[model samples]
Target: MSAVTDRTEAGAGAAATAGAPVMTRRLRVILLLLLGAQFMLAADFSILNVALPDIGKGLGFSLGNLQWVTTAFSLAAAGFTLLFGRVADLFGRRRLFLIGMALLTAASLVGGVAESPGILLAGRVAQGLATAMVTPAALSLLTTSFPEGPLRDRALGLNGAMLSAGFITGAVLGGVLTDLLSWRWAFFINLPVGVTVLVLAMTVLKESRAERTAKLDVPGAVTVSAGLLALVYGITAAQSDGWGSVGTLLPLLLGIALLVAFYVIELRAAEPLASVRVLKRRTVRWGNLGGLITFTMGSGVTFLMTLYLQKVLGFSPLVTGLSFGLLGVAAFVGGALAPRLIGRFGGPKALVGGLLVQGAASFLLAGIGGGSKSWLILVLAGTAVSGFGHISAVVSYMVTGTSGLPDGEQGLATGLTTLTQLVGLTLGIPVLSSIVTARTTALQATHSAADSVLAGVRLALLVNGGVLLVGALAIALFFARGTARRSATA
Candidate 1:
């Protein structure tokens, strides 16, 4: 019996060796396919922002109602990300990815055909659910497929670049579509791309199952998703209704209570979706906190800048989207350059310094009042500075946060990182929007809509700059100085 067991184990080892090369080739194929899919998903989020006015006009939506077109996708994506990540671990990454792509494609079709705002929002909600599945699965695939070294770093850098590129491309593409075709085509455009990605994914991606099987934490998933959704919705609604409104207050309070309950549930669950023990690590803890704050500021800035350029500066949608190209370029370059910077400066220094620089850049822009200045050149300079700093800080956090984790835990780590950004951006929009809305109202009492919008934009940037300053302080206090040099080989 002992001899037979030994022989079986030997045969298994031999088979693994024989299959290794083929597996490597398959992983490369899978990486490219997932990258393409991720780019499409990321692009879709920002692409429609510039097209929002056209869409509202075409659909006959009120300005306040139109925000849901963006809000629905965000809330859904943010709420279900962790839940879907856990589900992927339980089922299979390849399986969930395929399912997500299909759903996204289907939702795009529905969105294109929708005749009313309600239907469009429904489609967006579906798209959001699909994104929740796709984003984390894509990251998990990358983490598992690439061996942990320079290869992985390059892959991640490219991934970050693609994410930025997608946002830029989406803006340009959405503008062209809205101008030439109808706003409906902004969504319809996803159909062909999604199909192409799905086909490639099926051919190239190999299935991966969890090494240590665990049951789904149903209560945890339910409570957390619900809490996040509630919080996001309440915040967004607060822009229209007063923050103290009972409608908003009830959900906000419930959300906090549920999130606290989720923590307690996690402690008792046999297999917690996200093990608190993992988060206890210094790198993971601080990285998540800093990421949340930075991303919140990023979204707030982007939204305000868009409003300023289009409504105040009177730029065309196409031109407005095109203007962002410079910032996008900076983000791409910054991500590509981050690993080198981290190797030289260490993690903590890069993070804190980057945040400080970004905050300073926003303050610089704020100093330039909303007057009739050389609007293009001034905006470009400010955006480029902030964009470079933002990407630098983000890439640093990504590298440091997931660096020391075991392979199996990489999914949760990535999920946590993404969750922070997702939640931050979703919540931050309303926070910044409220500031803009309130300030716009006050400014309008004394000025025209154009001037009022510009004033609100300036105010939002100032507030966001202050928030980033706080983040910089947090980074310096928590992250060690040598993090920049830690990944020198990468």
Candidate 2:
């Protein structure tokens, strides 16, 4: 057998021992089905990025208002993930997954035809909801389908690769479509992809329903999702509305209060959407914290780079998309290799080592930032390597963090993981953007606005480097040693 085949067999064996259904030949089709769905989700992530300028001009939106295009999608997706995860467990994975795809497809079509920012935002939000529903079910299905061993590892690795590939592919495709044709093509592109994936999924994906008492804690889901939405919206708004403004403070305060209430409700509620017990696992807690930091830095870096390429480097949308291809390739390669790396070095060592390398790369790139210096090659290459390191770290954490939980608790774990990622991305963007904006504004009198922006970019990179280092330290000092192996096979 090929390495992938051998690994799949081992994963099947491990999963069988866990009392998961044996992976039959038919079951393997699930991976194929999932690939298309994952690609659609990942690609849409950066699709609108390059089209921001076009979108603003077309819709007569200010730069500030245009940000809602991205923000709405992100917060909606994050806010709904936990709710969807629980619903999937309660109802059925296959059913929910298909429903999500259908919604995403319809929403994409609507978005493509939107003439106003409000209509576009609405469609994007709907798409986000669909993403939330699809993503967790995809992960949960993989966990249940693949057995615990080499096969499972390979499967997860491939899953991660597809995700990374989709992200890069989206950037390039979105840029090309937007530049050559129109921004509308970016949204319209998902239509055919979604339709194809939906059809394939219906034909190939197996159905799995919760075997135990599949109760959903609606209160827990509502509170948690609403809290996250408030918090993220508040932060994003802070960039425009100012921290002291009621628009920012009210949402921020309410978000904190609602989140606190969520914790309290989870503690007392029977049939909680996310069991409080999962957080008790030292591995789960620390892993999630680490995930949060990494994701935050990762998203911030991407946002900064996207801006820099277009505004500073004078790269057209197509070139900017092409430039980001390096990071995407690195991520794909890293994800594809993660299973072997985990089997060899173990997940703990990989986690710490990856974070450290990523931090170093960020610092290196930041150090090389000067508009006169032809450092794009060096910086891009370093960022790519950093992406590689991050991929391994993420996949290892994901597998280990959810390890050993009862099948019933799997949805909770998925929900928590998604929650952390959402919170991280939500908070990270505005904080970094605000920092850069503040720094640039402060320097506008002293230097050209363009130069000030570059300076701000460099500062943002420095800060991200520091954040990555601190996150690495947290993994090494507080979490890595214990969870490395335990969580993998838990």
Best candidate per TM-score, number?
A: 2
* CA error at residue 351 for candidate 1, angstroms: 2.7
lDDT of each: 0.80, 0.79
Candidate 2 lDDT, 74-143, residue by residue in tens: 8899888888888877788889999999999999999999999889999999999999999888878877
Which structure among the candidates has the greatest lDDT? 1
lDDT by residue (196-260, candidate 1, tens digit) is 99998887777775788888888999999999889888887787886889978988998899899
Question: Alpha-carbon error at 197 in model 1, in Å?
Answer: 1.3
Query: Which segments of candidate 1 are over 4 A away from where they belong?
Result: 1-28, 371-373, 481-490
Q: What is the C-alpha RMSD of each candidate to the true structure, in Å?
A: 5.8, 4.2
lDDT of 2 at 280: 83
**Per-prediction TM-score:** 0.89, 0.91
RMSD of 2: 4.2
lDDT of 2 at 346: 65
